[model samples]
Target: MKVREKKRPFQVFFHDNAVDSYLVTKRATKKVVASIRAAYYDNSSKELDARYRGELLVYQTVKVRQRQAEHAEKFYSVDDDHCDLQVDHGEATKRWCYYFENISVEELSHPMNGTRLR
Candidate 1:
């Protein structure tokens, strides 16, 4: 008998500004959602980090609420750039939520390939 791992259902929410700005297509939205979901299931997913840190000009932050009555916050800055997606794992609710913001479609679609601009 094989035991199956239960997959958690993640909810992806976009900031009103982000939806109105760069998330103009279903494809783009799906891509972002998939990336976030992958990250949630596996914290060590290198592909997720590579997409944001290398190809895309998007910043991501991960925060896990501490398991304490005080409810302290532990922040993880994935990169040096400004945050585009604020991924939060709630301790009380045991819910995964992705807050999207600071989207730059043009820059993300066509990131510079190590070419210095004068």
Candidate 2:
């Protein structure tokens, strides 16, 4: 004889709309980039006691305005919980012994303003 089992999957919903936001900057010159509409947030939830654990879903929308043109785009992504643990006592000891034998920033010099603006 055999027994039957039930299983459930995760659910998600995504939306697209203009998300109003702003960018604030402070320096010698104070400026506030206002009315920069971008991707907005959507509702998200997960089952607390489901058959599966360590699952995530994310939704985002973005807006682009170029030369009197505007458009909106939506995106979705899902991920799972993963990690690794290891033991390397010998390697750790070797790394700690050479920690202070590195060079300082002042001992090296490089050029700036060499990058071209796209």
Among these predictions, the greatest lDDT belongs to 1
Provide the overall lDDT of each model, using Cα atoms, as 2-decimal numbers. Answer: 0.40, 0.27
Q: Best by TM-score, which number?
A: 1
Model 1 C-alpha lDDT per residue in residues 1-118, reported as the tens digit of each score: 0111111111112334344343344445566677777776576455456755633323222222224423554553232235344344342122221223334223466656988879
Query: Mind giving the per-residue lDDT tens digits that candidate 2 earns over 1-118?
Result: 0011111001111122222211111111121112111112111233323334313221111222342243223222222123222135564445444443554324446666668879
TM-score of 2: 0.15
Question: Once superposed on the true structure, which residue ranges of model 2 sit more than 4 Å away at CA?
Answer: 1-86, 103-118
Clashes of each: 0, 1
